[model samples]
Target: MSQTLPDFDQITDTLRALGAESEAAENHGLLCAMLCTMEGVTADAWLDIALSGTGRDALAPEPPEALVTLFDETRRQFDSDEFDFHLLLPHDEAILAVRIEALGHWCQGFLAGLAVGGIQQPESLPGELPEIIQDMLEIARAEGYELEDDGEDEAAYAELVEYLRMGVLLFREEFRRQYAKAGEGSIH
Candidate 1:
């Protein structure tokens, strides 16, 4: 069904979908922790993989060692902003519009970091690009600009983040469903 924009289940599902790529429950949990509140970041959903400098990208030529460091640093820089960005956004409502825009910045950095040599990702044509890239293309359709296409040609990396964003969007939709019936006289 072409669901309503205000559904609560959908929103929460968007919140959790980003962590699905992790094989380890702990990995998922840990990443999820970054997005959720302290009370929500419990052990049950925590993933073990620590976000650090040594994390490797199976596809990239440049071992993602430094990328890990960049991610941690970026996270620290953005951590405070996430809270303020969402402060006015209700659980089932929209997150900050600017944050959505900033997502492109993060995607650019992530994808650019994964590129090798110069211009274009190592992704070999036809269909090698991840689902995320396609999703980002879909997301970027509105803007109609070449995003994250740095000298490295990390479009595939951009795709990966786009996919993650799409997943998060789905999780958000699911969340809207779960919470649709919560609270009386609700303004959702």
Candidate 2:
């Protein structure tokens, strides 16, 4: 069976219970970016970043089971031969504004993840990556739109999401090629 993302609200609740301050969308975005850019990114490393500001210590609680499941399922999506990876965002039924805001947060987190994954100089990257990073920066700052109708706004939102999904896949492929050329092995 095809693995699917965990429920957004459920992951949100789990993160809250774990004292994580980041939203589910942002956290998932970070995870995707790290997986793409970092070699052998482990679940523990991701947890360290995701729970960074929570002030958790050695005596702190472990990540909840639901969050762990989310991490595994998301990683599986990237490894799938079907290219089924997708962003973790609020469902379509959510208010358009809420969804839009979440998408922005996701983009912000993705950019942050790229930095965390050691991509400090995006401008020097090969192919379309530099432009893609610029586009993500703009999307991250998005607040609201001035579309004429709800239908139009919905179409626009869907297009943006699709673009982001494809962009991420491209990043993964390009980075993998770079690593291979340098004999650095593949990202996990």
Candidate 3:
């Protein structure tokens, strides 16, 4: 697998070509959340959600090879202790509004992924996770922002992204600790 993530636009195009209803950012969010919350989340399971409502079975469509690579690399990043996971969003060059909207979608997808991953009660989760989940819920509900083309919005966006990245890492770590305490095997 490649060390770096696949191009954002390329994954978006592939999703479109595969008739996936979810956008790349949202799909990626779902993938990340599932990886963080669940014990065994396969690419096929992710595709089942990502490709839902398209009237085609995920396997029947034979998702593009790039998508498989994307899943592998993303899983690898999450498994590593290097903190290399990243949200799949538009590059810095994209319009701020577009990026913000995508961020909301990403958060929405993440919440949905938690449900899909069998996290029945996020509020019951240990430590600061419940608060973080609440914050993510608020972010998912955010609609729009009134702002200029100033650097402030860009900086805020960067901060939000970083917060999300760290929050997800924390979730993964906490869950892994729980599993370890329960005498469960590695959550791969």
Each prediction's number of clashing residue pairs = 44, 0, 0
State the lDDT at 83 in candidate 3.
88
The Cα error of candidate 1 at residue 29, in Å, is 19
lDDT (10s digit) by residue, model 2, range 1-188: 68788899998887786688899999999998998898788878898999887765553667677778888988888777688988999999998888888898898889989888888788988789889889989988876665565698899899999999989999888877878887774432
lDDT computed for candidate 1: 0.32
lDDT of 1 by residue, 1-188 (tens): 11112222332233243333322222322333233212232222222223232222332324233223322432333233332111111231233343344344334322332231121432332232345444534543434344452433344544544455444334233323434555322111
Q: What's the CA error at residue 103 for candidate 2, in Å?
A: 0.5
- The count of backbone overlaps in candidate 3 is 0
lDDT of 2 at 147: 54
Q: Which ten residues in a row have the lowest lDDT in candidate 1?
A: 83-92
Angstrom error of the Cα, residue 107, model 1: value is 1.8
Candidate 1 TM-score to native: 0.24
Alpha-carbon runs more than 4 Å astray in model 3: 58-61, 185-188
| Model 3 agreement with the true structure over 46-161: per-residue lDDT tens digits | 88788888755644657678788889898999998788888889888999998988888889888888888778878888889899889888988987589788988889989999
TM-score of each: 0.24, 0.92, 0.92
List the global CA lDDT of all models: 0.32, 0.85, 0.85
